[model samples]
Target: MLISDLDCNTLKTHLSGQGLRFRTGPFSVSLRATIPAIARHIAKLYPHSETLDNDAFIDFHITTHQVAGLRRWLKPQVVFSFDGYKPFKPLPLAQAAAAFEWGLNWCIASSSHQYLIIHSAVVEKDGQAVILPGSPGSGKSTLCAALIHRGWRLFSDEMALLSAADGMIHSVPRPVSLKNQSIEIIKAFTQEPVWGERIEGTTKGDIEHMCAPDSSVRQPPTAIHAKYLVFPHYQSGCLTEITPLSKGRASMNLIENAFNFNILGHQGFEMVSDLVDSLECYDFTYPDLKQALDGIEQITSAKP
Candidate 1:
């Protein structure tokens, strides 16, 4: 059954009771939280996501609960838990949705070592996937959301799962998180991009999640070979430009941007190097969103 099939009341009951098990690409997530905001966000953002059986093996069992004592009554807060253990301090109760999203990211990055998790945004088209690896202020999420709107399949906005054996990247599509000015930028661009709710005062400033397209959310999990490596840098007034980067440099960047390079050691290096050797690397910089996308479209449309 799809998650949206159940109303808010039913969802809340399931979460508070047996928990809600759902498939999220490579991981089966079971979420439990008493917060109505969590229920509402799931109802809206995860409408197309499959609701799995409780007997299913879960990769992450997460929950959020109100703190005990007088603190619960005065300036109430919520703490996120993983496997019955709270990993983070309490956050303002109003940020429950944000906390839930952040907690899910932590669950993947911290524990899921089956794949080499890279801090990158991945999107695919025409059997070719472009891996966008960047640091803060790199406009990776912005580019990801834009490409999804333009019809590219969303792989992931935060994490790119690279297999250690075959070197293929697995899709972990989820809601694209938008922050600060990028929120308004997307709103003004798309006619009605599916969005959950606007949250303010986040560590990354105002944030909201652009819902994964129903097509992407419902797509069967598949692994695709990486065809291009894009290191995107966004500047206010610069003209869109793409520069070819050497395979050696791209491999180094992938290792540096990887979440668990040290964990995998030599195996990680070999996996990243093999993947880079097969792709054409580039440095992409842009100011105008249209021009930026056009540049990418032009690149992806070519015979690789």
Candidate 2:
């Protein structure tokens, strides 16, 4: 059943008790929380995601509860626990949903070494996937949210799980988090009807989460061979330009942004090398989203 099927009270009851397990591509995450906002957040943001029937070897067991001591009544903070161990300090209770989102990402990036994880977003069209790698404030998430809403299939907004056994991208299409001014920007950009609450006062400033389309998240996970490796940069008043990057440079660049390049060692090297050799690499700069989307279509649709 989808998370949307459960009412707010029912969702809270499950989370406060047995936990709610949901599948996103290769991993299954079971989340529990007592924060009222969490249940509402999940109901809206995770409505497109399916809840697992039972915990048969769950990948991540996570929870959020009121902090202990005087602070529980004073400032009212929430602590996130993973396997009975608190990995992060207590955060303001208002940030419960963001804390949960970040915690799940940490779980995957730190432990899921079976796949060569990278800090990038993956989107596909006509069976061709474009891997986007960028630093913070690089507009990666904003661009990703735009593409998925436009027509492309969302692979992931935060992490790209590249298989070592086979050179294919695994989909982990969770909600795309928008930050700062981008929150209102996206609100004005699309009317797709999948935005969560506009949460404020996080370290990243005001933030919001947008759910992946039901069709994208419900499809069976398929291993994808990447077709484009584009490093996107959003520059105000700058004309859109797609500059080619050499395979040698692209490989090195990918390693710099990879979450577990050294962990995979030789296997990671070979996998990244193969990707560079197989796909077209480019540095894409844009001042406007529509123009950038146009530029992508011009390139991806062209004969390789």
Q: Which 10-residue span in candidate 2 carries the lowest summed lDDT?
A: 48-57
**For candidate 1, lDDT tens digit of each residue in 18-67?**
89889887789999888888888888888878889868899898988777
Relative to the true structure, how large is the alpha-carbon lDDT of every model? Answer: 0.86, 0.87
- Candidate achieving the largest lDDT: 2
Each candidate's TM vs. the true structure?
Answer: 0.96, 0.96
Candidate 2 local lDDT, 96-169, one digit each (tens): 88988888888898899989998999999889899999789778999998898788999999988888888889
